[model samples]
Target: MLPYKNPELPVEDRVTDLLDRMTLPEKAALICHSRMTAGPIGDLPGDLFPSSEELISERGITHFAMMAVPDPVTMATWNNHVQDLAAATRLGIPVTLSSDPRHGWASNPATAHSGGGFSAGPEPIGLAATDDPDLVREFAAMASAELRAVGIRVAFHPMADLATEPRWARISGTFGEDADRAVRMIEAYIAGMQGGTGIGPDSVACMVKHFPGNGPQAGGEDPHFAYGRDAVYPGGMFEHHLRPFDAALAAGSAQVMTCYSIARGIGVREVGASFNRELLTGLLRGRFGFDGVVCTDFNVVTGMEIPGVVSLPPRDWGVEDLDDVAKTALVLNAGADQLGGESDPGLVLAAVSSGAVPAERIDEAVRRILRDKFRLGLFENPYVDVDAAAKLVGASRGRELGRRVQARSLVGLKSAAAPVAPARIYVENIDPVIAAGYGEIVSAPEDADLALVRLKAPYDKREGLLESAFHAGSLEFPAEEIDRLRTIAERVPLAVEVYLDRPAVLTPIAEFATVLAGGFGADDDLALDVLTGRAVPPGVLPFDLPRSQRAVEESRADVPFDTADPLYRCGHRCPRA
Candidate 1:
């Protein structure tokens, strides 16, 4: 047996032996990660989407981006099956499975896959609202264990991007607006996922994402769309956004995922972070001393015409004219170790042969990839027990922790006289069965002593295809909705809670509601717990609530807390009596 095949050998020696034995195609495969579905194992026919067997045997791929987390038994079974295929390959390089954050409350399929059997928790914003670094760490640790239980070794999470820009569609996935606070949260997050011992076999390596920070998008548009590609800095505060990433690196994040947005007007080249060598190589690598693997955000190398997403266009931002091969070359030259959302190694293989990208560059990328696999102890035993996985995922302790954290994340923006215990209650957008536990389920506002209304933070509705799904555009609530909320307040004492995906203009509703609350991806029970005084409202505003849309428009996109006369400042919360 080769040295790489010997589990007792030092990881460095094993990695070297593996790299030496790998073919050019195999090396290329290591540097790119393609998407994989979790379910009963079957072949997915596409150039980009291939079955686990095809990915290992034919393509020589060793990394996969996973989604739609199935039951733990199914996931573990599928993972073990994939491992078996890799075991049959020449090098037997085990697959490093990765997934977006799965436990978030406002889980966008684009951002976080469903929780499946895992404990569902608040979004990053909600967790940050609690202002508890220890809680964040606990959640990350629990999430890490759940991820590892199902045979996933990588957590593409702790999205350290600051929610500086209020309208950015991805803000719900972020820690919040303050750089200092975000840095602290990020450090705790990395430590939790990687563990105190650092990223070893027991740990699920965290990919601190959208490096250099993905906040500060121009007009609050996300980079997933061609129209939203340029991430501008009108206040010239680009370095301010780097605080969290810098802290994350110091905390020893195992990987960095570059964003799709191009840094415009920052004296840097106007190219996507994936295509910009200066940002990826010079700033992140040279200046910041990040030696970890840098993976590109999804679909940077190829054009994707997603069904029902005609409006987004392709995410090729700066190098739109480049062919797939050239795009692959550019991404590699920019120092990205892996092409996320891309499966086909042929483009990279062609680029190397044509001398568009050097073989040494590919070798360098593969070394980092292989080292991570070795560090994860995948070479020793890549398989997991399905029965064990079933028991571990969504374990009772994790669910209890999740529940406590959820209750702690509720921020009371305003406080009023508490409704008497067992008072008649009218609830909207809440499960009636759950509301019944709190009080009598009244049929009308007139019959209720208190009306509880839950609203999503306002977004300007977009037209046609893809834009409609994102919570972007305007931040103001519709007039009719506000009027209705006001009417309810007139009839009965009202408690209004906003599910804040982004900072909303809430002056209208705030004026009318007797009590105001805000949270991110919280369950009805948690909110009710806080409302009924069963749990204290321990959360504070993670980011400032702007007074109006005009303030949001006038504020610099790159700076936190820049909105004029914010209705409620960061850290503001109504005190418990």
Candidate 2:
């Protein structure tokens, strides 16, 4: 066996053996992280891109991020087939499969996918609301096991970025707005995902994301769009944002994904964190000493056009004018190890051929990437057991734990003196069948003894398919909806629960709600269980509940707890009845 394929050799020696043998094209392919859709053994869907076999053979690509969540048996079979393709390659480098967080309820195609066959739980914000590091660690450990079952070796999760900006669309993925709490949670998360001893056969490498922090978006807009490209630090809390990442590194996180926003007023160049040399190299590598794989946020090298719905521009940010090859060169020069969401290895090859990017830089990136694959034990056995995957993917224990956590993460904003078990209950945005389990499901509030209302935190509808997925814009409910809610509250006592994807201006809802609760990626059954007092919610506010839209606008996006007269402060929780 070759030194690189030897399981007993040191990881460094294995990496060196592989790096020395790799060609320029192979090296370029190793650094370009692309996406793949799951399908049957020989027939894989590409949506709009090339097939998995074509990418492996023609492009020489070995790294892929999975976009969909199929059943365990199918996923495992697909993964094994892909590994077989990689094995047939010139170097036979094992394919490393990565995925966005697939255990959560928040289903944004651009960010996180829904828990299809995995244990379904609350979003990261729900975990933050619970304020328990042990629980976070447990969740990560469970998730790691499930991921490894289907051959997914990397987790693009434990989003260490703080939800400092209440209006930010990606807040659901973060650990609230506090630096200290986020640091603690992140440390525990990394420890759990990496199985405490660090990346190994049983471990799923954690790619703690949006380095230097992605939460302080200007106007609370996401950096994914052109309008939301600027990540401004008005409160000068740039260093504060790095706290969780510092903790992640300390806890042995295996990878880091840079944000897409053009960071403004933080001393570095006004470009996306992935393209900025000072931020990626000087700060992340130099000051913090993070030597792990540094991957760019998806599609930083080129703009993507999603047919007729929307023409999404490339998030090159400050370097928008540069060609795809130049942008690829710039990202490598800035010290990133991989170009995520990019399929074309030609960009990397062209950059090297034109002498704009040095071959040594490509080698440096390949070494880090190879080292991680080796540490993950992918070199020894890349294929997962198809039969074992079905039995292990979503075990009963993990599902029960997820259900319990979903209930526990529900924050009680207002509580009744005792659990209200009304004979007749009216419901909205809640399953009537589930409501019937607690009490008689009524047609209207007037006919019922109590009314149960479930609401999603309000967001103005955007035009595109991808744009609409992000729940951005206003946080306030429409005036008509508020008036409708008020009418119901006047007729019958109202129990209101809002899914706090982003911090909503809940002052009006508070006035009418007899019992107000906040949820993060919870199901109707879980929400109703807490509402009817079958389950006890022990969560607190992860972030401040801003009083109004005006207050949210006035608050600094970069600073936590800056809102004037918030409805509830961070960590606020009502006493359990």
Ten contiguous residues with the weakest lDDT in model 2: 40-49
lDDT string, candidate 2, 414-457, tens digits = 87743367899999998777778888888988998888889999
True lDDT of residue 570, candidate 2: 93
For model 1, the superposed segments whose C-alpha errors exceed 4 Å read: 43-48, 305-313, 463-466
Index of the highest-TM-score prediction? 2
Per-residue lDDT over 1-577 for candidate 1, one digit per residue giving the tens place of the 0 to 100 score: 7898787888889888888988898888888788778778764334334567777888888788886678889999989988988888876788888999887776565677656788978888888887899998999899999889888889888888888899999888888998888888888888999996357888999898897768999899988887788888888899888888888889989999999999988888888899899999999999998877999988888754444434234478889898899999999998899998888899899999989999899888988888888888888889998898999889899888887788788898887766767479999999999999989998899998888888899897776555666789999998898888888989988887889989999988888887888888778988876555565577878999999999999999998899999999998977662
* Candidate 1 residue pairs in backbone clash: none
Least well predicted 10-residue stretch by lDDT in candidate 1: 305-314
